[model samples]
Target: MTGLSTLGRLAPLGAAVAAVAERLRPSVVTIENGSGAGAGVIWSADGLIITNDHVVPGDQARVRLGSQDVVPARVVGRDRLNDLAALRVPREGLPAAEVGDSRALRPGQLVLAMGHPLGLSHALTLGIVSALPTDDDERELIRADLALAPGNSGGPMVDAAGRVVGINAMVASPGLALAVPSHVVADFVTHIGEPAPWLGITALPVVLPPDLRRRVGVAAGLMITAVERGGPAEAAGLLPGDVIVAIAEEPVRHPRHLLEALARTPAGGDLDLVILRGGQGHRLRVAPARRAPQADVPPARSAA
Candidate 1:
């Protein structure tokens, strides 16, 4: 979407993005729970702030609203599988990014990504969807070629309507960027009250040596790089090195398949994780945990 595309779809988009960023962006504090501080967008009013799960792994990350006020956020819920997470912000009625329909998303549709790229907080980037699902799971993807930087994790991607379409997740060497589709985010947010860390791990193309693929007799499929520490998979003893071969008995041909599996499951439920580790297969039943908000303050503040 054009920076103004969201403006085109929804008039007063400039005002809307501004307001949403003011409200939702404030709720999106920079996280330093080991993943480093970056931007996140508020998805709901009752403190359900959406961000990339990797940012706030622990319950003690810092949530700095607008300006410089920092607070402590606890883990309220998490979806490590889908890479979408919720954090609680102390301030109420924060501006929130509008959620748009990912199903209606068309390739080459104008899209925009807003986040802290290159450690520059609140920077905005533009790009097109570039591709779409071809019988593959749609809920798990938000592929684009827009510019992205390391610090842009957990930011929002908006449609012309200024509605959020995806959440920043990964970028490959060729500048291909991937995000969690808003619909997939909706599914995760819908089931946040679970007792365990229940998420479906999919295969990700981690940079394993080419020889590893040949030895494993697999060409290309998402590999399970790491599970959330002490999360449903961890609590269930699911290890980081394990590769997810399938979900619900369906072969996980790609990373997005894991997204489909997690979207289909309920919070507080057990998932049968089929994994390939050391060339051996195993099944593990895991329950996911609820995502949490981080509470922290800058060790020091500065004025530039």
Candidate 2:
């Protein structure tokens, strides 16, 4: 009798939790069109944080502090194929996030979502790891049931240990979120000593299909969809119809798989391309010429 129906009993507890969460949120400072604004998060401290490439797409993208302070962020590097980007702020003596290994993560493991949802500022949501999608990059990603919004792009997803396991990067409407797993991210940061071109490719994972599972065939790799004329593929004699089965003997699937193979292949060095054409396979070794530039989005932007 004392409980005032279901709705009335839930209001106060909800308000208390919201209050605490608001205070704990971090800020993601976005600099666009030469203007700066705040985006919130759970980790405000410093070092380097991984975020969506679009968050800092241009020559400049910096993060803001909880106290409304701004820090200049530069492109540490980015993986366009995966839509994952990493930026570093030069704020030393700031709080850095603790990196957690996602390898040990199990399905339904407790996880928290932190970001600038809907561009509103810093926000946090609770959920559990629903799945880990293995993209062609040979990296395992975090998939969760927590609600993620637009502004929350590039925030940290921490676990009970207060260590970051993923970066809040994408959402599938309503309440699905996907993150770049921390393990791959950590290696990226430690090794990203230089910037690399983003060869937009739909790298498919090279897993033998059921029919070919036991045949000891080529590992699935990026099947060349459309090659930019005069681009690397064209210069190297890679055709649009070519199925890039591997690079330097490593199996590849369509899209990023081939590019990854190509990227690791030194520029100007003799590269071996193993492709399937006309249901038959061929291996060609050739020097990789510089890939020519592409046209800007037609009708979207004229030649500048």
Candidate 3:
């Protein structure tokens, strides 16, 4: 009798979840690349698909529509900074997912994670918004407790109202699923097919120890893990293992801050950077250059 009552109480909630899944199923798609397959969401009725840059590693990928139609899709744009990429397929009258403001999301709010996880087609998982990245993070990644798998990399995280709020991007340790907020996705779509300035470096944000923090006069800094040869960063004398503490007098604590500071410098213009190398500080001026096409240059890996 108690089990029957508990089942009765959960029936409405189960039905509501099922309804949302059915509503967003058509807009979700399977994106297959040379590496593997992931999920993507249709962002426009004219066949614009939004996915993760990691999902579509190269310039093009194969998109499988809901009707089981496989078509070759071109990479319209990829913003490696935010881990979001857009694709264009030759089709019309497609179902577009309704995007919602991620800023409006509250902690503990019910959300649905839709994706094709572990080769399973059209999988739906439930969870709540665990946390939102602080302003300093810049990427606006949404942290949720949703169960995610390898194939869920580029799917949509929809709200109870069936509005897409974020795109599943990566999962962190200790069971946290991260997604790129919809607002960031919208910005990437706005500048689709446009290339941004590139400062060829692979960096990771690191927190300095108490003594080092006091010595560097900052709490955090970006550790230059890799400096591209013949690139602007290398030209500026930025070597691997150097810790960048500031840019043009502004303290840079994260990769986003460094990127924003670098974006302010025009092509061929100098950006004064303060780097701590070997327990000493050195100021180096770096000039950023316009990024080349996907075929010409390697993408700088900075997201961490």
| Candidate 1 local Cα displacement, residue 77, angstroms | 2.0
Better of 1 and 3 by lDDT: 3
TM-score of each model, in listed order = 0.61, 0.67, 0.77
List lDDT for all candidates, in order: 0.65, 0.59, 0.84
Residues 1-304 of candidate 3: C-alpha lDDT, one tens digit per residue: 9999999999999999999999999999999997899999999999999998889888889999998999999997876777878999999999999999988999899999888999999999999999987856646689999999999999999989999999999988546899998887886686575566666887877778899878767887888998888888888888888988888788877777776665556666877888988878899887777764333222233622
On TM-score, who's better, 1 or 3?
3
Ranking by lDDT: 3, 1, 2
| Cα-based lDDT at residue 154, candidate 3 | 92
Cα lDDT for residue 187, candidate 2: 54
For model 2, the stretches where C-alpha displacement exceeds 4 angstroms are 1-49, 135-140, 193-221, 225-240, 247-250, 262-273, 285-304
Superior by lDDT: candidate 1 or candidate 2: 1
Candidate 1 residue lDDT tens string, 1-304: 5876755776665565565454445534466566567667777766567788777767656766656677666656766556666787676676666789887899988777777766677776667888765634423666888788877888888876668888888785456788888887887787676432334232354433577656655444446555655555666776656776666667665544554555456765656767677766678776655443222211111000
Ranking by TM-score: 3, 2, 1
* Number of colliding residue pairs in each model: 32, 30, 0
Model 3 segments more than 4 A misplaced? 1-9, 135-140, 173-175, 199-212, 223-243, 247-250, 261-289, 293-304
By summed lDDT, which 10 consecutive residues of candidate 1 come out lowest?
295-304
